[model samples]
Target: MCVPTNAQEADTPTDTPTEAATPTTGYFDDAGNWVPPARDAAPDTDNCPQATWPPEPVSTSERAASTPDALPVTYDGPCGVSAAEGYEVPDDVLASAWLVADLDSGDVVAMKDPHGRYRPASIIKVLLALTVIDELPLDQKVAVSAESAGQEGSAAGIGEGGDYTVEDLLYGLLLSSGNDCAHALAQALGGDEMTLLKINEMAKTLGMTDTRATSYSGLDSAGMSTSAWDMGLAYRAAFDNPTFADMVDTESYEFPGFGDLPSFELWNDNKLYLNDPDGIGGKTGYTDDANHTFVGAVNHEGRRLVAVVLDTTINNDHRAWEQAQMLLHEAYGVSGSVAKLAPANTDEPETTTAAPSPAAGDDAGQEAGTAWNRWWSYAIVAGVLALAVLVTVLSLASTKKRRQRR
Candidate 1:
């Protein structure tokens, strides 16, 4: 899951709570500080004008519905529901936009401003991981460059000039929200520009119409955008990839060391993974501009469900995970489809491919690890077979080995 390195899951309960309790309702002041309403007073839902297509910042406005004609009629309002009459969503939900959907059926159970545009923060790493798993071989080693080693935000501690397996880098990307690991993977995929090109291509393939990635690390960037609906699509697509599924589901791993770096343990920081037995996996993210964003899945009563929360805040009483749990709980027995996730468009031409790793005879000979050299040569020898088939075969075998080991 993606998060700033210094943040802690202090609000996450060691055990899942049996009841969903609403937290205190508050408003942000002129200085962007939270101000609770008067005691026993009605929530000031009318503090500002109604919500519109391009929602106004929550710090300055009330969130009532003004766009009732929006797509997916059931979810066209500020607070949406697909349940029976009198069904009230948890009053404490604080996200500017959120969604809960059935993974298997692609049925959207409930939502609030489902299509509101927002910054994705680090949760966009989900797209990056999916791209890496598809294009690069897991066992292939990448030599970390200084650019990747000194990435700006959270890090997985990969050292410059160190050799790391693609699989391990992926672990760092998801488990630790490592911007450094993300950059290294982006370079291996052909550098920042090409990687963004491929990731946006993948987003289109998966029918994530509202997403446009600007950086592989999911840090705030110009034009980086995603919606709650799009994040739901991302997590749903992720369930089909065994490697992606396995990595997110893993709670802890012994991340390897290289060069002067020492080995350190990495733990899955997705609050759902840590606190709920039913939570399968998820991604987390945060940025000053994006606030806190989360995408998570759960297995409940034989049904698989995914939830997304965007542009939320962390008060003393609740975190993003807690809001997700409340939404998922409200969603379990509900049985109506306000909307459906679009299936991938197969006719879209597949354009994202792994960049050819340089061979030993090339400039890469000095820095390429022995394993990387071997893999590169083997890839050349197996060029007769389609790239898709080779990656599928290797991924299946690797997943089998991982499962068997457990």
Candidate 2:
């Protein structure tokens, strides 16, 4: 015999609602809003007056599973979404940018428009420094040329016609990002032409296929462009040099004066050195064309991340840093690692092993060596000079055409 289970009788209602209904429990809509039944209300039944209270709202968990932040996600290892929250980078912040490889392992991490051409700004000095150090002995004295001393922006307070050791100028160049230092170093190495040649040669050697340099100082010169990836490549190449790395990392320096000049103090322009304890080093740049630009590296935990931001709007340094930190956190999450330098591509003939450190020796031999090295460094300089000329001619031609149209 079949016996009726409680489920069969559960549909029976205990109470019914009157015309002037007092609210009892069950499903009911309160003016379009779902109102859950009070604890004391009776359950809905098949036969009875309609209840006043609405049914319970659906929980997010009961809704679509594809929605983000429905629940805390977990992964077995470090390879997962970034744990650091509250960093939402805007998509349109920088027109062009790129990031790559940990400082240690040389593995490329992430790239945003990596190959896009943009102004290198002061970052160009990384290559210039490499060329200068390779060609000039650190202890050798270089007389400041009129061209170098006359450099317009961010001077190291170096006087024209006075002599400074290669070491002091290198420090001035990296720490202060001085245009004067760059020109002095260029003149000391290969004059203008050879200095630029060495920079271009180094670019070629490093596989910077899209990079072009028009000046050693990275002053606003026409057609002075390089891709973010190319800058990263240049950084990787320069990082191996202990002196170069040390120079960039320095917080402050005191330059000994010459003749009647007083000693001068210089501080690093990179804000990261002061703000971030893990900041290894960085460079900052700004021009009407380049806008606010920065290339910085941070060491988090055991990993190192390098970030390059270009063409950002003015007064957005904080935003730039935020974006960089977010990208680094994401890269760290994805790879469970940070940036590393790429291995030297032996297949490329232009790529040479890092220049050997100069040995302290005879002053004449060193000067001769420096001069000879400069002579060989003219190719990049010529390339940059040509670019400058091209830019000037184009500007003039455009002006003339506009006048004719008017």
Candidate 3:
């Protein structure tokens, strides 16, 4: 099947029609506006200015407020795949973009903002993990690179010259959202260029057409992005691999230090693991640009429901989990499943900010333009400082203890 392609940083829902629907052709401009892909028409992807640290992701609020008639995107809220038939999506589900699907049958149970391309933060590590797992053996030993060890953000406290097995790195990558671990794996597997080639290849094989593999760690890079729908596709492809399942599902791991080095402890961030009995495991993501994003799964009886929630904001870290929980309950209650999401053109003007309630008539969308908001940036900065301090303190203490022992 030829999946419709859009030539933009963000997805502009296309009319695939199997040569059935009217063909819509365009790419997104630098302003996140859709334009034809013609060289004269579309913004040059090569010359597009890369986003800097104090970055800003495209906002849903601004898009909602735009003139609807000129663009391919007519709607600003959920793709309209809601509770119907036996499924029951509550009226007050809180998420910028979300989806719950049955991986067993490749069926979409329900979805919200399915195609909204948002920042993934560290969650893209799942794709990197999935790719490496397929190529490297669990016991394969790898030497950490300076570039990898010096990476910013969360880490597994791997030393500059640490040598570890693929299995150990996987534990760190999934359990701790370790940017360093992700980089080490990338260096071991291949450099950035080759690693991304593999990841994009994996995405293509899984039919995640909306995803762009711009970074190994899902750190907000120049053009890296994914949607809830795309994440649903990524995780579905990943969960099928037993290695992927085992790692994310692990609550805690101890990496035995090499020789006299200090051991590292990694705790899983998939909070659902502890609170929900049916929760299998998942990855958590956060960045000033991406806000709080998540890709999680739950298994009940014989069915597995994978839920992808993106951009829950910094203030409400639990919103994504709660939203996923609601989706699972409603999915279990729903009788049958959609063969897949048959989302119509998202061209409509119904999205508006209103108090979330049980009222189905209320458009299920929140005001969401300011993604890289000031508060979120501050939070990210604080988190980074705290993590840096943690790594530094641990390293200093370990060095002192080693000197004493010698």
Number of the predicted model whose lDDT against the real structure is largest: 1
| Native-to-model Cα distance after best TM-score fit, residue 230 in candidate 3, in Å | 1.3
Model 2 CA deviation exceeding 4 Å by range: 1-95, 315-326, 329-333, 336-406
RMSD of each: 22.2, 29.0, 28.6
Model 2 lDDT per residue over 47-144, tens place: 21111111111212113222222111111112111112333334434434556456665665655444455666577788888988788899999888
Clashing pairs in 1: none
Ten residues in sequence with the least summed lDDT for candidate 1: 8-17
Poorly placed runs, candidate 1 (over 4 Å)? 1-87, 343-406
For each candidate, what TM-score against the reference? 0.67, 0.59, 0.64
- How do these models rank on TM-score, best leading? 1, 3, 2
Best by TM-score: 1
Q: Would you give me the overall lDDT of model 1?
A: 0.70
lDDT of the candidates, in the order given? 0.70, 0.59, 0.64
Q: How badly does each model clash, as a count of residue pairs?
A: 0, 18, 9
How much is the lDDT of residue 70 in candidate 2? 16
lDDT tens digits, residue span 259-336, model 3: 578786677867776578888898877654565677778888878888887755322223456766767777886656
TM-score of 3: 0.64
Candidate 1 structure, TM-score to reference: 0.67
lDDT of 3 at 377: 88
